[model samples]
Target: MDTPLKNLAIIGAGAMGSGIAALFASKGLNIVLIDPMEGALERALKTIDRQLNVYAPGGVQEAMQRIQVSPGLEAACNSDLVIEAVPENLELKRGIFAKLDSLCPARTLFATNTSGLSINAIASAVVRRDRFVGTHFFTPADVIPLVEVVRNDDTSEDTVARVMATLRFAGKRPVLVRQDIPGFIANRIQHALAREAISLLEKGVASAEDIDEVVKWSLGIRLALSGPLEQRDMNGIDVHYAIASYLYKDLENRTEPSELLKSKVESGQIGAKNGQGFYTWSPERRERVLREKSAALGELAAWLNGKAGGS
Candidate 1:
């Protein structure tokens, strides 16, 4: 039998790291959150505290008590699992993995919360490549249920199984990604849709708001319940094939980022983080949208959980 994962060490105290730490800690697992930057630990703890107060009010103190913040990498030495959520630079990740490889025990499982980096290359930095895997959690990790568990060529079966079990125990829906492909599963599909959306905008086919409305009412609503392939099967494979045959030739297949997006970035209108992008976002508008999205996701998460339980 495999050993149960009791303690986790997250090696970044940014949004993703803190969110992940809060998630495991709330599930009764001990977490050590480490970052070398000044005030990072305090900021992360504040964020975790605020999120817990909003979502799990009764368990805020208990969860907070389970997390220990440290400014050194050595704090992760005794952890059962170590997850690196650093910035998306290849060399930076490699450096961190090398340090972690030397500091952590041989039995410790190492996972990277990398979005699109090569898992094989990252695993190569560590001595125990077989114990290294990828655990890609979405933004607002505590709220999102989906986690892409990516296994590379050298990742052992035991490593995958243990990581999957731990994620499931933490109330996450972990999907194993067999290959170390760019963007993994979700982001690949998401970017395909985004590319087409931007293509339409660039060609003046429709306003961004109208396109968004169409997607939300049409594709988004259905996808909330059933996945694309499953929906395609229900709609009839023959019909899907016929539509694909006709539409495939005309679909957007650009290898480069859309000029519209580039221009937006050049002009410093880089979406909600700033003030505008494809759409203008005032501070109030951004807050309102975030609140609405959070509430909707919360409701959807509850519904999905209930559905899974019934099954």
Candidate 2:
């Protein structure tokens, strides 16, 4: 779509922002990495080079000239699309969009890399509400293949379809979400397992390792071949409907933290990002692990493509 998103701007030079910039540039798009912080824009560009070499060596090696580093909001105003990946805070995100709304052309598509924000709220800051969409990329965008293309009530069908096609051309799985709600589809399903896993830990039901092992060995295998909705049909809808009727409440967030999770997170056991969570590993080691996961997932994707009669 749109000739592989020929011009893209990733505003903000944070981790997610740089990752997004790298992904577009690696896909042979003209990319602008924008930020105002001292050295932030430069650092993000360097990080893009470093990350691309790891995520898509062949593509980035060939498309290394596609990226451009810029230090202000004005640099992104001319882009075809601008993806804001600033901090998780709402006011800051709105502020960026407000400025972008004033600066960018009416045709420029504005997207957010937010994980949990409401798409409607984000769109309110932009003038072209019909052109704004939630383009959520997973961590390390250049490597991760699945991108959630979200559309709220204000978004136009053309924008949604264009986003889907652009991402598809970039060689990513674009999951179309009909309705834009909090957490969207994958995250709702993700949090379901997360809450249950934490509950098991709090109740002394099983260690985190054992809990993860069970899911990874079983549900993970089934998911590898088919998604949850497909698995439901394969396993029989009657059984799923019965189970859903019985276990529906288990999916919701009943407790805030149960004190145990609160303590774990508050005490700096905030997972691999901080070298600890339920597991421990050095930051460098963790990146290596994630790279391995990316390679494995990429191979699976490639094989799946071949099976589906794709080159």
lDDT digits (tens) for residues 98-142 of candidate 2: 998999888888888889799889888877899999898887676
Flag regions of model 2 displaced more than 4 Å. 242-255, 308-311
* Deviation of model 2 at 208, angstroms: 1.5
Q: TM-score for model 2? A: 0.90
TM-scores for all predictions:
0.96, 0.90
The model with the greatest TM-score is 1
Range of the 10 consecutive residues with the lowest summed lDDT in candidate 1 = 302-311
| Candidate 1: residue pairs that collide | none
State the lDDT of candidate 1 residue by residue for 170-199, as single tens digits. 888899999999999999999999999999
